[model samples]
Target: MPSSIPRSAAVSSVVAAALAAGLLAGAGTASAADVRIHDIQGTTRTSPLVGQQVTGVTGIVTGVRTYGSRGFWIQDPQGDDDSATSEGLFVFTSSVPTVAVGDAVRVNGTVTEYVPGGLNSGNQSLTQLSRPTITVQSSGNPVPAPVTIDEESVPDAYAPEGAPAAGGSINGLTLDPETYALDYYESLEGTNVRIGTSRVVGATDPYSELWVTVKPWENRSERGGALYGSYTAQNTGRLQIQSLTPIAQQPFPTANVGDVLADGAEGPLDFNQFGGYTLTARKLGTVVDGGLEREVTEPQHKNELAVATYNVENLDPSDPQEKFDALAKAVVENLSAPDIVALEEIQDDNGAKNDGTVGAEQTLKKFTEAIVAAGGPSYAWRSVDPENNKDGGEPGGNIRQVFLFNPQRVDFIDRPGGDATTATGVVEGAYGRAELTHSPGRIDPANTAWENSRKPLAGEFVFRGRTVFVVANHFGSKGGDESLTSHHQPPNRSSEAKRLLQAQAVNAFVKDVLAVQKQADVIVLGDINDFEFSATTEALTDGGALYPAVKSLPVDERYSYVYQGNSQVLDQILTSPGVHHFEYDSVHINAEFADQNSDHDPQVLRFRP
Candidate 1:
């Protein structure tokens, strides 16, 4: 939330005294200015007259600021009649001009486009008037009526074609105020808007921002949040509420999905880099909690073994001791310290130092030490070091998947002769069942799909009388993919191809083990970096050889990660046909909270082996 300057009438009189004090108020009006607010705002994302000087822009003062470089916002009472252009614009006076809301004023300034992020970012810049000289034409002038936004007004689709050639750039296309979500938001950028009694769709973020849906979400859930679907069908009804009220002045409201905003909110619309369009609230209403509670899963029974997957978000020995402690608590208290836990993003011994330090013995040791200190069962880890710099992640961080198991409950089958370069294959071991040639070895290490990515770690673990093969994976991320509001319709999922290939490789390996033993209990789990309803998951579970355990959880509780306003599942556990009738839980210790230790929530599965 950016700081705002106080709009005191006394201050306005002191700055623009010639008009506000008495003279200009008596005159009542100024001659018609050559340029209007719409001319400076234009229809596109970038201002058409950026860097050009404009004179005599007239509008009523809608908002005034006194903090930082104090300034005020002005909006034309009668706009250009073009639905595409915004009527309001911010006037930066550098604490010079004191303007009160409802004072009609004439401003002269340079038209500028301020990019929130740098130029390289695809984000559109904010159009503003800088170094403005203000003259109050009249005081007590009525401001423009705020446009009301309701469910029927928001469109289902989010954006037009996102590619540059397809009018993806904000400046490239003519916005349709009623058709697409992006268009509707762009049309209202920098204008006064009102949201009638809406529901909180997204949990409040640390910045005091929450997403709300006006009314009648397309796939409305009982929780008052819109259910996530294909990206093409953007959840248009959902709008982000950004509080301009400083935390010290008024605290940002805390809310969860299904919470009701009885009075809704009204604010000046703003566009920023993080979320496309946002409302800087002038009046924020009350929040009624949905009473959503964190779910506690049942503990594993005597004969039952619980296996879990957790992404520690690149944990290293150098990380804060508290982070490790918090993670360990989530595993012990929230996840019940499963018999076997597949850990992702475990860096090498040197942490992030780039000197070819591949062994993670020190890293795993510190984590297990913290777990024990946190009252969790003492755990042992098994992992094959990867060729440094070959696995993708941070430049110096060789992030890989590792297995942590409670030795008292499960035995990790370790075979000799495993190395970073060689691929692991299914082979006959002492038990005469299908087994990894090398426990905790990379599966198809040389596969092109695993190139510069985290290779799957296949390790065999035996609990009681059952043997379960676990494949721990961290797939390629959705890095270069377009945002939800991208110009390209159905924003391209650029990372899907590589993940599909990785999924195929893992599926092939699972098939080999199942071929050796039709009922081989193989568990593949980790941060797949995709949804359960994605093609990547389809590739992994093709032929019904492995089924996603997440699908078994209730739909509303299926999410393990929350991005933007969507509570989506990016981490998943897929089990072989041999493993059935298991209880699963997507532990929600993180993701929904503002002070989450990790970006992802861990999941656990319990069943009789």
Candidate 2:
């Protein structure tokens, strides 16, 4: 049966009321054959005896969760010799159980499988026992020794192929813990597990969780993060770490990328909605500063033009002044005040208060004023205000791409008459140079490819004696994509197709500019919301219309975003052939730190025309 309320506190009240009212009368009290933890958690992802009453299940309590889905985990110390079946299982008590660690207990309950985010979320089911009746057989019994999770323990292969009859799902496959990494973790699903002093690859978030890697050498980035280079190399050693201890009892560590979790951690392995295969630590580790410093790109020379792209993450006038100030400092200090910056996610004034208001003049004014306050240049801005509530973002915020340029360093060419629906075209200009038909205009905004997504914003600028064409983009997000730990092997990226089409549209627009002037200088930059090696990037750079500048850096250093312990590329700067010989830097200020102005790290590109 599908779980109606996964991890919800209401589950406790409902289950308790049912038991108190005899709604499930004698469900767990019936005389039945003894069932070991391994038998309940069979070789597959689901329980074999689901919907049946299981009695005389005996084990020692390893951990107790007092909060959400209040339950206690029990493990059979005398486990079966089979390596595929887990020795432990979670007994959902609904309310906090009186049992403590090391207490040997006999449990009687109904076997059930709980999918964290519901059945349609594509997550694997977590086999567990519910409406448990517990009897403390003894106290002070030793808990099962935790299995070490090291590089030698986990397999290099991610998972085996799904059965042809199962529609590419590995859920029905038998566990091969020795052969596949996913199966290896599944084999110890609810059991006690431990990792050595591991490197903190993903920074700790507000959720009081962080990620660490047991295998330091697996796809290691130069900055010590696990680099997700492709779909195939998933870096199996990465695991999520959360504490079973209450936050009121002890505050979670504030860790950044490259930090060390000293002394390691031991915990009950769990599968959840956010990050699958999480280790809810009963014995958590402390953080040791890794001395990771944020990098600053060198300032542009007098003869060179520096351009940058940053996703301010829904910046609006309603946000705190400190946020605006922090972003201004990042732009001025960390980015060295690039001559031109293509900003994404600049929300309309009065953020998220879904009214008819779609103008962002106040938002831009506040930001530019903050830039000057941070001892930076007086930056002028240009943008086409998107139609109210049409672009996908905060309900009514109407986020769009904007151009911020230092008036002293570059001149924005304004050809009037551009609006929300106007599509910009390229035309031959003075001295056979290419110019935009409407500066700060949307590209193919009416096209279905941009249907609820942000359309590419194109603009014209002149620096020194050369003209440059810049297209700022914020493509469709990966909202519906499955996690790397999905039950479907090689998780399907359903959001990729829309991004690929968006990339094609931008590519075609750049091709139009290049066609008008063979040596046209075009810079397409922003959060494409796809990886540098993804098909979206390939489509953007198809036929050599543009080159992704982020690829010029070392593979380890190409990422501008980090998600779920994997450092990856989502924002990029792609240049036309005429703009060759440029220097690119994915400034690592925000994404690697727990305290950040934005989730995306800004990228800058400098080249001499």
Candidate 3:
């Protein structure tokens, strides 16, 4: 049986017996001297005396959580010399205890290794006192002063490279309290600590949890907010804030990046599954928003051609009509019904039926019908279906990229030789510009780099007598990647290398077209699944072959996705040199709201073509 238990449930009989005994300290006090908190919390995540029963554990109650795993944390007034071991411990009472904050209590309980997820879950294990029996020695005792955590307290690096012991995870590594962030947090686990003069780095979640960073980044910090961890500099200061108070009494305030916890959050440090190190805030201060608001792009110019890229998030025929209607509204109302839209994740006719159906004609027709019904112009679309299971996405869905263009605004030039197996190539055409042999064709579909991924769909459109080439892509995802709070300091990004190759393939095709016509209007856009500052983008923009359209916006305004309170850019619209001086808008319709239609926000670029 797994050790993972519901927070509201009771522990095993052994732990229950210990708890019953501890609570029934009855009438007499034990003669045993109070043990220092650090003695029970050794240098590692697990206690040295784990699985053993101990008595006279003394401390002042610092915080009490009444709802789940009804428990309170206690910290010793006089701590030990070893900075590697924490001075605080949680007493799991299973129900609200009679103990009050600032009360000097001596607890008798069994020490155990409580893995938040499970023993095999690779989550950080917390050392806690379970089934505790408490004896309140006195009331009105002063709580120990919280240890202030600032830049000097946390290390620059987050963790060591490999296993602590052979075949073990970095979680079991020996403590380097002053050198690694993981080691430092392990040292202070279950301790009443303080983050003085702190600012919120991430937004507050529905669960009332927020992330903050105490230390400043060595490199020029972006708006004093912590960047996601990297190899060169692991963001060691980032810490999650978990409120212990009930939602009704103390609802967590809504916040954004650069918000201030003016009084500085103070709490007992805890290690949990979702976030590695969290402070169960005993006292939460005021939150000041950094003036971050939902961004709106300027409307399109009548004479200029407007093109947009949107990830429809697996729209298939089998999906509900409301989803299609909502997506059409997003395109018309939010995206302003651009002349041309590059759409990714358009699924097959009978989505996920696993019957080898590959056409998306019904899906396209339904979307167009919805668009017209939503007060938008009727749109025609083009797409090439991939062989079953060859294109990576939702299994059995066969998701692919497609282009939706209004006949009143642009014309999609059609040619021959477009099929699932035949790769599209740049060829000389009648317009004195490079053209695709097939208007809507897969680019290098058979290439190993595109294995199990959506092949880029290249299409040529004539707008105002000028040919504009558009390549719609949906790259391999960042799936199976390690978590940001993983045991590894800067968790490995195994997906980046594959994205680089995809970028290279697309870049080579762009270069081939540009070589023939230096001023070719080429638009490469879709769910790139990478940041603007990443190696994948670098590959796309090498030697100024293409310019990222999002760069036109202010640095603070360049984002299309928000995850874990972080506003970031994963979808982008990059264009060739010919298509310059364009009005670009990263319309913020979805990413920030709970009622989002898609994970990605659509982007539109209006330019003369």
**Which candidate achieves the best TM-score against the true structure?**
2
Worst 10-residue stretch by lDDT in candidate 1?
23-32
- In order, the Cα lDDT scores of the candidates are 0.78, 0.88, 0.78
Candidate 1 per-residue lDDT, tens place, 1-609, comes to: 432323344433332442233311122122324688887777666566665567889998876655543566788878878988999888877664577888998888876665443333444556788767889889998778888888777776677664465444544566777677788877887788889878777778766788888756566643455667555545778788876555788888888766777788877777665666777777789998777655566789989989999999989999999999998888888888899999999998778899888889989999999999999999998988888899999878899999999999999888877778888899765656898888878899899999999999999889997899999999999887756754345556778999999999999999999888888899999999999989999999988789999899777667787766677889999999999789988887677655577888898988876
Rank order (by TM-score, best first): 2, 1, 3
Give lDDT tens digits, candidate 3, residues 310-385: 9998899888999999999888887888999999999999888888888899999999999999999999998888
Q: Give the worst 10-residue stretch by lDDT in candidate 3.
A: 23-32
Q: What is the per-residue lDDT of model 2 for residues 1-609, given as tens digits with 9 covering 90 to 100?
A: 211123554543443453455322213332346878988887777666666788999999999888666798999999889999999898888777899999999999877666676555677767788888999999998889999999999999988876666667787788999999999999999999999899999998888889999998998888889998998878899999988887899898999989999988998998888888989899988899999988889999999999999999999998999999999999999999999999999999888999878999999999999999999999999999999988999889999999999999999999988999989888887777788889989999998889899989999899997889999999999988887878787677899989989999999999998988887889999999998889999999999999999989988897988888999999999999999789999999988888989999999999987
Candidate 2, residue 45: Cα displacement in angstroms equals 1.3
- What are the runs in model 2 whose C-alpha is more than 4 Å off? 1-32
Q: List the candidates' TM-scores in order.
A: 0.84, 0.95, 0.76
Candidate 3, residue 347: lDDT = 91
The pairs that clash in candidate 2 are none
Model 1, C-alpha of 574: deviation from truth (Å) = 1.1
